[model samples]
Target: MGFNNWNSTHCRAEFNESMVKGIADTFVAQGLKDAGYTYVNIDDCWALPDRNASGDLVPDPARFPHGIKAVADYVHSKGLKFGLYSSAGTKTCDVQGFPGGLGHERQDAELWASWGVDYLKYDNCNNTGADAKQRYKAMGDALAAATRATGRPILYSICEWGSNQPWTWAQGVGNSWRTTGDISDNWSSMISIAHQNQSLAPYAGPGAWNDPDMLEVGNGGMTDTEYRTHFSLWSQMAAPLLIGSDLRTASPATLAILKNTEVIAVDQDPLGRQGTVVSDSGGLVVMSKPLADGGRSVTLTNETSSTRTVSTTVKDIGIGGASSYALKDLWSKATSTTTGAIGAPVPAHGTVMFRVTPGSPVPPPTGVNQLSDLPWTSAVGGWGPVERDRSNGEQAAGDGRPLTIGGVRYAKGLGTHAPSDIAYYLGGGCSALRVDVGVDDEAPNTGSVRFQIWRDGTLAADSGVRTAADPPVRLNADLKGATKLRLVVTDGGDGITYDHADWADARLACGSGPSAGTHELSDLAWESATNGWGPVEKDLSNAEQAAGDGTPLTINGTVYAKGLGTHAPSSVAYYLGGTCTSLTTRVGVDDEVTTKGSVDFQIWRDGTLAAESGTLTSADAAKALTADLTGALEVRLVVTDAGDGIDYDHADWAGPRLVCG
Candidate 1:
């Protein structure tokens, strides 16, 4: 963990030698050094816009009157590391066009090392459209040579902005790679970057990280709750937590967030495992990072505008076989106990972090259940997140409609695109898995897919090839005594386009009977409803200001027939009677408005916000929204005008369903 000036000061006049020195001083005086934030890095504009007579970068005489080495020496005097920034191109990103290290990688590396620089935040601007890997690797090789020649180790950071999939090849090239564009001090920017970085967890570990840009904790654009979520997610992603705010003026709340030792420990854990998303339905997301000491750091993120009860199971986080677990809230410092279930009431745009330690060993759950109800060890979908109890709509999670194959809908199963792999921990308990597999009817006549069931390392069942014209084929896999179960779907000797696949009515017979199922929300009667333009329409989009003047619900080109559609500033309520366990749906601005509408979708359990869609426009694709309604008496679907005028704000709650007993 360290501090960088770009996000706060940027190329402003205050980014001078005295500011750098003051940062180092603040790090020592404010217990930041004790919290392990060492590096005091300066971003662009630290040097002159042009090179010197001998082709050497010259420090800006006005900004660093004493010289770059002097600032480095002062930082070292404080027992802190110093970092500098440059671009791989001919010029830095600033409008002043500062000279970069494009053809002078070796020269710049040696110069920075001579000045006692320990970290380099290489940028991506002015690259002249060269191959990303080649350009980045040139600097990587130069840094290695400089380290050997100068006998000084410098951490090389690749800032290519994921233009060329650097995570697949940046292992030895740099200590970290930027996985997304620069982040702003807002909830949408921070959370969207987190979402982009979370899927690449497998590419991150010790000595190599996925950089999602710098921290915006102390930035004034967002609330403290949102900043905590940002910090929690960054730590969980194993990202380099370079503080992006001005430390001299940082508030106590910001310092507390930056110095949370419990949270930092998860990032610095020797296991070096980046947290993986355990479940992300609606805006409630659960991430689990395996700790070095056999514990797990769990982050329950509420990305909506209201509070929610985000939850996950011990087995879901790759840990179980324990009767109980000790849960320590990393943020609140509260301790609790859980019998496999881990959850909390997280505030809107907040995260509840916990370090869970198993208390005693025990067997895993053995009840017969729908596979969608269980947690997968790993799930990679070709298009979007794997959907539960829906067809693979090839859009966002929960965007899929009911699990339909050959025009028949099944109430429970998994929805996946081609080239998907979902694995679950069976713990040698499941005796069999029965599922009807087929290419989803949504892609009928245009797609083909193959399905395979793997029991541990052995192939238990395989469907050669199934096309849309074919009916649902039942696959019974003998998973008796298997510790793991993997469901694989591949493109059927063709490209992946339109290859939506389904595992319909997937039931696993483990320790008991009675598998779970879901009911479509459109098929259920609503307790009450109101709309901005007209009555809420069932299984259709609100085309006109009338009850039945509607058409098939469509968002970003995908069509659905089973959902509620209404204008913005609308409310639709359903009575659950505390029987439903979850409600999953995809929400977006209905395509009836083309690209001219904006709206926000929210799920309210009783009176509290359970999930939210942030702000979505007609140009955006459908987004997943889920809520855990374990004991909810009533659930409400709400759509607002997104703080803008309500013109053309036709919102659709696409393919909403509730898992109830």
Candidate 2:
């Protein structure tokens, strides 16, 4: 089950001018010959309606004058493979209710094999999740059976819409699988698909590659930088490079980039280690794949809509031991050697691919071999920041007052279960971070424990925590600049002990942020909860009462101030109660707390100053302060902290309920 180097597609129909003269086939032949990209595929719209009354597959007599057989022969004549498309269920992706291959899979496979079809891209549009694996295996087995029946070795390509991890089973059934949706001719769409493929690299192998739908290289809209990133990531992910563009009109620059053998060699490396994202920041990502000849292929991609510099060292990709290496730029055909590491300039949505050939021999493996070696600690009581210097630490909350873990106790409770802080690779140039915490069976109370991260005192991400204890709590963050990371656990409604927390094992994906022409935080859920001053049912189940915005209502204790999102002290003032008699909540941005952009604070009762714009302060009780003076004041706290030159930092709403004299 050895995998081939490249599986290319020429999506001529992707253009407005559906049909091409001889140029479509000619361009494909050239790509297959020059670029070493096999499988000159004909995408949708190549066939006409069903010709036979029995509803058999047929080719468009006008588009394919010599019929499907002739096209296959032409492709074979160019020393390239020929592929076709079909549906496993009812309709194809193009909305045509094509005959399903599920019922007549064998028959259809036989017909295609007889017609000299070398590969098949079986799609899943109208397909349901009725035993996805079984259905896919059925088609794959049918294809094999057809090959045996017709004496042809037609390769099967499964396209199940990425419902499940097809790579886990697709290799047994087909040659490759689609891990993402269809590709469009835009930078955002291309980078997005590429990033998704990066995470599933370990599942990709020779006969089973992750298909990021197809390529949009020669297509319009995307720039040269974007195309480079697209090609670089696809190559590193070990994905099938199926081109979805008008090859005839492709610019010379595009031709050169695609034809670069050095870059393509990285893609075709026999070692077949799928690239993984190392780190990400400000729309930039660092990815690396092991090469066959004891080297690595690194790609620095800037998925931001604007150009940015993505600096990274080889050490960031678990290659710190490599003292010296030669970096061969795939796009520029330039070479540079360094003793330390290297950084490259990345255009907006662009990438820089390099062949990192180590100069030294292999070293013995040391330390934890697997990613799960790092220890994870659960938030003991109400999750929040705990001031623990080391193993000899104090504990907070419940019977587990002095919560012990491996002979260590975290005073200040298990610092809020921040998802963003859980998964981060410090000193690495990666973006998205995830942290997992194993919860104990001795469930006390459960409430939403929202995790908030501050980088250099700026809010990074406000992640939501799950109530269930089956799976450990998860905190994820996408830090954009501001190196130092901080976690803030707003509130855990109940008192459940988190046993272990896993951190720093994730990376940021490309194009994950809201694109241009769209409002930031527009998709965030906003609601109002007032006049229902209800007693709080604190537990992991109702964690939102402890965390802000997890639910509609804000829980106010008799004399305690509930935690909310971290905010800068200078720009914000939490006004509790009504306008006239409300308490003021203030934040001071300075030294430890660097603020950025706008800040939002809510009293929960009145929608006063939900978000304010201006330079923020990070000063503690020093300069930023506000008092709650309204009658029946509940809880007031800061929510959002934007980082566009504004400081954001250690924020908490303080209140002590009045005692009746």
By lDDT, the best candidate is 1
lDDT for position 68 in model 1: 93
Error of 2 at 361 (Å): 3.1
* TM-scores for the candidates: 0.59, 0.53
lDDT of each structure?
Answer: 0.86, 0.51
**What digit string (tens of lDDT, one per residue) describes model 1 on residues 1-661?**
8999999998999999999999999999999999989889999999887899999999999999999999999999999999999999999999999998899988988898899889999999998988788878898899899899989899988888998888878888999999999999999999999999997875677899999999998979999998999999999988999999999999999999999999999988997878878688999999888786667899999988888899988766656545678999999899999987888899999999999987745323543357887655556566665788887666544678888888788898999887777777677766777788999988858799999999977999999999989999998888778887889998897666688999988866564322257888998777678888888999999875667899899989999989998898999877664456899999998877865889999999755799999999989999998899885556889999999899899999999988987
Q: Kindly report which residue pairs in candidate 1 clash with one another.
A: 282-625, 282-626, 321-362
Q: Which candidate has the top score in TM-score?
A: 1
Error of 2 at 332 (Å): 1.7
Report the Cα lDDT for residue 95, model 1. 92
**Which portions of model 1 show Cα errors greater than 4 Å?**
363-661
TM-score, model 1 to reference:
0.59
